[model samples]
Target: MKKRFVVLVIAAFMLFVFGSMAEATVANKQIQVNYNNVKIVTNGKAVTLTADQEPFLLNGVTFVPLRAAGQALNSTVNWEASTKTVVITGNSNNNASNTDLLVQIAQKNQEIVALKAQVAALQAKLDDEDTDEDYDLDKIEDKLLDQYGELEDVKIDEIALKGDDDFVKVDVEVDLDDYKKEWKDLTEREIKNWVEDLVEEIQAKLNSNTVVDGMIYSTDDEDLVEFYKRGKNRLDVYIINNYKGVNASKVIDSLEGDRYSVEGIRFSIGELDYEEDKELVNVNFEAEAADVAERWDELNRIEISDAVDKIGKAIAGEFENEDVPVEAVRLYFYDEDNERLGSYRYNNN
Candidate 1:
């Protein structure tokens, strides 16, 4: 116990000596510090010193406790040892260089944040515009029909009536089977007369004029006609100068075709019609490759192969099948000068 007490007393003496030495050094040495428009004080007294008056250094570093300097300048100083930086904060009482740097950083950050928000807003607006640009009316119409129900014979497919005008465009799909039973054994002349009589009856009901266009001649040389005959006998009747507000499909249903009407007719038709020019309605039939690449100056090797396969299938009359796959089909629309105006692609798988 005595030995332990001696050791403790010796340790205390060594600590006291070191503390005194530190205090002596602080009191003897003087430091000359220059601060921009800043004054230092200690214990409510102003501190003025020059670099030549007193120079104090500790462990290769100049040590100045900020509390003393800040009190003199009427400001506050904070030291962050982790980041090895000093923060000289200013208020109504004091102004400092460090305060200016912090202010500038905050303003720059705010600007950056605002710019980021603007970019995000612009991107969202562009997305909405792209969606609007891609809107397709044909697909919408198909979707609407699918949602409601499959259009049936004698049912009104669409009705567009102009309140101030006397003209309307009506689209109709007729069920040939309903009239085929009665005319199946009839001669071509009888069949023609029967069709004419039916059109007259429809015109009288609608209180409108009628004009019968030339009949479509079926060619035995075409394979499509043979394939069509293998399935069922069908006919398309294009009625012009009909009732202005009448539903074409409903009118067709009223007219007797086959002995009985079917549920709904399934067929594909091109979206083409006659346009009035001079004294007559010019009806021209034209078809071209669909989705032809603009860069194709002439048919490349790959494109030639594709064209051969497409033309071959078209000749075989299998191009109309929805399940028949084709690589590409481009349809081009041209004027009388043969200058291309627009193009479209059919990608049915």
Candidate 2:
């Protein structure tokens, strides 16, 4: 009988392992129990149980096969034929402290809720920062116009501001008639001084309102129009559009006294070199012999080096910020026929 019972258990185990094994049904007066599909998990991975050993739920109670429950709980399982009952024996630690597990699960749920709340608070803070950093173009333009409008003889037509850093780029448009009217009577030296003062004032005001690193001011008449740039080590200006250098000649002429003058001397920037370590400027001029020859002897004998240095410095001073130091000047003088009369190069060093 013991051997027969052992054989029955082995046969049942084989039937589970190889599901194609036929099942035996014997007529008995035992209560019928139905099984339904229910999943079992151990250490987070799914465990597939055969139909005979699978767990099921009925009448709000879960019923698991003896062997399946023993394996899941890591316990030893034994069957008793006298009472037809199965017993599971586990170590002291695995004696099924379900109440402690419930407490642990509740604590874990509370921790998850707290983590979700923290994430939501951080997201809200980020949203508030984004709102505070928004830019208002209309307000910026209004403030700019208000400050510049107070300057005499400057008719502000347009103002544009870009970027939100220590370096703000600005572009402005205005009418030049008023500015010319203010400077029309000033001598060349006085004009330069006035422009320098004006530039400082404008730069300060703009910087105070917002950090300004570069600016371009344009005029309808183009007089006193300035393109201003400030860099770590250099500042510069270029006369654009007038190939004959008419505007440049006028500016140079303004610097002359009664003894000698560069008036009516049409000139252009023949070459400009602005490499990383070298900065050079070259100017070419054409004038009537009568005008140039009036100081011919004096011109040749004059301090050419001093004259070039003064011219270079004056040109550099026009812009508010200078990054590169002007190092040299090359002058090419021509007569009425555009024939080169003389050429000279001066180095600051």
Candidate 3:
């Protein structure tokens, strides 16, 4: 009983001394003096605190580095040297392990920057490829000149390429005077065959040209081919074999015009007569003008003439004359009654 009472008195005396020391430190300079009995533990494991950050006891008061203490307690630690302050934070409860996590974050940012640079470089390469694919007449013209440089019978005056990713249109002008000298009396059919052969050669060379992505251009693509004379020269170097991809059936489908009679007369084109020998296309159609049969001559001369001209222009895009002049658009007109009216011809001669 005496021993227990003595032990309680020693414990009360120690508590009172420690409390007074804490109050003094808070009120005074808060400086700590060295005491060799400090220890640190983290997550149930003993941690060896750094020498500079070792805890100490000053006049019976304990002191520790804010960083070391925060880490030991699993709390984030930040020191403000300017204000001489320490801040600690955590998710669920303030926590921290070591400086390794900060290093990881920095490395991740660098990787992201590198990836962005790689993507930008790939995009630049693709843009360059597209530019090469776009048509450039200078390159094509150079190729043509190189191929025909030694030929005395051919002179390429101009070359042009146009169109988009869907297709490419090429136009080449050649001086055929030398060609004519060789075949002065050649039939039109023979001349047309010769021109086609020339086109094939040019098309093949263009497909294999090195200026762009080779093998991307083709002449077999429908509606992607055309031939035209050079500007202002008008000496008909080449011809569009299938202009606008229009034909006799397409022209017949495109005819539409009113005769302006009492019954609102309309014109309808029928069978197309191709006079290859004379270079003419005879358009035969019946005009529904039953209300004004007596005025057939006047109507045939004026109304029919104007109608034929308009119709010819509309269907002219379908012709494949290949530099051969179309002498005229011969209109063989008949009334709804099947009576043959006088024919009227139209031409841009």
Candidate 4:
């Protein structure tokens, strides 16, 4: 009878120990959950839960606990429960923080909204201008052919005309051979100008009765040339078309100044008069070496000129092929005092 009691006591003790071990294992195990396409894992493994997955709304801000999500992504996390936000800082260099991610998402949304607004505004403006009645299709075609010689052989594939509307959509199909034959002689700049002029003329003809507010978008090669021709006394004036409310005189005045070259300062003038009763107007000018060095010291901060010279030397050394000649180097200095420090160019030849 005593032996039977001992066996019963031992069995009871064994069961109790096993039960405690099972409970400890359950407590130590990790839980996993998924929310808003982001995987959240607790500890090393995924947590399985049947809770309705919704964005955690706390204090008017949406947040997810970083500790729950970071382990799955192999990242570090810190939770500020007081602020109801979890900051999941990634261990990897490419990993972005939750705050940065949110900001980026917000910026993308703003850009989309802005683009939609712009499109709506443009559509409304087009609709208002469409009230004009008179539009001569043949005249438009003739003008296009005259301006763009390549378009002369182009066949009008489709023409969609709306009744009493100023604007008509015309799609043209051109023969590649004819286009190449005619347009090959024209420079890229000339081609761009031709297109812009044609568009402006067509718009004007279409909206004869309505006041149309539109701008021509084209590449200005002349502006690029002006930008490159530093330290010249004369500027080659090329105005494609006169734009209303734009101050052309002010722009011309701004360009008239002393330009810098690597060797010296070059003076530029809007207009010049020489001997034999000949007047040179809008000329780009170049200065002597002595003048440039003197101006560099006076006008520019010492470090800027040195930095520019170093860069120029590096460039010259890199492309030291016999066919390529390093002609000149120029630097434009715009410091706190002088905002319009003219561009300087260096010429070896």
Candidate 5:
């Protein structure tokens, strides 16, 4: 039979064998019982029974020992005289003594509950991301063409809008045909004014239906200039926009006398190394370490990555104000032992 061994734990039983074992034997006559060549087979396995406990027939009625049968089925047999009952039970241990399987079942149930909770959480996140907001790219691009098609030297090449909610992706490609100065000859003021105007027009004409985070003014797909919504005035600069390199020494002189501190790390600028070809600069600090830092002891025990980040902000900030030709700057830091702690590069600064 298909079965799971379940134990009721408490038990009672009555058997024919117990009657013959009474202390005060009764005066009685017994007839011979038949063996009948009986065999005990349980779930395809043979069970050996003692001769005295074997199957027998009394007055043509068949009987078997309860204890032997229960043992063959991996169970417990109990006899209760007061209740005149026989109880059979099966569980983790043969006699229902071990509860290890019950404990394991409870643990597995808890894990299943935890796993189901995780799945529910992930599903909630997906539903939140599946927003209904939509922007028609074709309609927006066509409207832009209608607004800027009349400028002889200006060409509107491509425009695309994507994503949902307040944050969205908007990229524009514009090409200048001819009758224009090289991009480098155009000053930062000139470049910033042109792009900002276009951005304002796009926002007004579309009734602010789209948000532009960046725009590229190119020639035959060659990126001549790109405007990003970051920097000193937030949207006031471009990458490699102004070509003439600034005097590196002058930029350093402006920041050398200044001292800045963040998270107990006092920092000062020493020298500025400018690479004209790469349009990059390495702004170095004066000393290997700083003094008069009250919390330096606390900072020395931890990582110095974010602790010393703002040290070079004054230098990069000054370079941006002067419309410096450099595209990026690298900042180097040292620990108390003169060992390099970390190096960081600020792009489009």
Candidate 6:
């Protein structure tokens, strides 16, 4: 335990017990004190007051600086703001060890600050790299423009990115002008090969979770003849019907409205004919149920025949109000191996 009472008494005595001798020493705009008068000496030398430190004399008594005296006696003096007290403690024999500990703590604090700075810099660099790899949409557009812009058969018309590059929408035009090979000329094998090439090239440069929304083209003479899509592991090639003065968009729309040419069940345009004597047009198509695995072998022949007959009449009805020359439709239900599952013909005359 600290000798609190003794320390207080010594501090009080040093601050106040000079008996008016301090005032006697001050006169003529200067104060002088010698060894005979009240003075504190450390190591055989008297302590001199600086401009900020002075003795207080009042009513025949004197006050001195206790902090100076306390330090000279090998003590550590501090003010405790929380307790409102002046604490004076004697120096320990291990004072040098305490000073070394304080220095080490300061050095460790500097090292920690430096390490935090390095970590922050590294995290910022990582965030920038991630933005480039996962969020930048412009890079994908530039790549498509460079590769598909100058192809002979097709050209990239538009590129759009959505949802942090999670989806890539590419619109392309298949050139069929100058009486070139129309989309109807492309066989199933050709369609599959083209779609495979496109998907393979794009996915090779993208992450697995990304989806590509490629719209081949629309009707009304947009300089495109085909749009390809997939249905439950089935590759689809849609051939646009663009006979002169014949609007086929309405017909396909009608087919989709009746659940005939969408998703699992789809239809493709086949051979077409126009009967000049009868003023009637004949449309041909290959209707397929893509979801049926091993198609022809797995499906029932009776059901297939009935389905094709209904589909043909439904197609003919779609052209009833059109300005086309005639209203007629022919449907061919076929698979790769079977070659012909069923067929139907209709004429609304």
- Candidate 6, residues 1-349, lDDT tens digits: the string is 3111111225557534533334455456654432213456666655665645554444444455667777767777786778545677877865887989999999999999999999999999998896576455677666666665533443444444444335566565544453234444433334445655665556555554546556555333353334333322322334344333344443443343233542244656554444433544444445454533355455576665566556665555555555545445555555433366555555555
Predicted structure 4, TM vs. truth: 0.24
Write down the lDDT that model 4 would get.
0.39
Q: lDDT of each prediction vs. the true structure?
A: 0.34, 0.49, 0.48, 0.39, 0.55, 0.52
Top of the candidates by TM-score: 6
Model 5 lDDT tens row, 178-235: 5244444444344555667766655543435444566554555554455544212334
Write one digit per residue (lDDT tens) for candidate 1, span 156-182: 132121111122122223232343233
Q: Against the correct fold, how does model 6 do in TM-score?
A: 0.32
Q: Per-candidate RMSD vs. true structure?
A: 21.7, 19.8, 19.0, 24.6, 18.3, 19.7
> For model 3, which pairs clash?
74-95, 74-96, 75-94, 75-95, 75-96, 76-95, 90-94
Top model by lDDT, which number? Answer: 5
As for candidate 2, its clashing pairs are: 233-323, 234-322, 234-323, 234-324, 235-322, 235-323, 235-324
Looking at model 5, the pairs that clash are: 12-87, 13-79, 13-80, 13-85, 13-86, 14-85, 14-86
- How does model 2 fare in lDDT? 0.49
Model 4: CA > 4 A from native:
1-133, 147-167, 172-174, 178-186, 208-298, 301-349
Ranking by lDDT: 5, 6, 2, 3, 4, 1
TM-score of each: 0.19, 0.25, 0.24, 0.24, 0.29, 0.32
Which 10-residue span in candidate 3 carries the lowest summed lDDT?
1-10
**On residues 1-349, what C-alpha lDDT tens digit does candidate 2 reach at each position?**
1111111122244235324312443355544454545666656655557857755444544455657645665766777768554555665665457768988999999999999999999999997765444344455567666655533443667667676534556566555455545433323333334334433444443443444443334465353434444523222332332212223423333223212224333444433332223345455655534555445435544555556555555554432134435466556666656667677666656
The lDDT, on a scale of 0 to 1, for candidate 1 is 0.34
Among all windows of ten consecutive residues in candidate 1, which has the lowest summed lDDT?
222-231
Q: After superposition, how far is residue 300 of candidate 6 from its true place, in Å?
A: 15
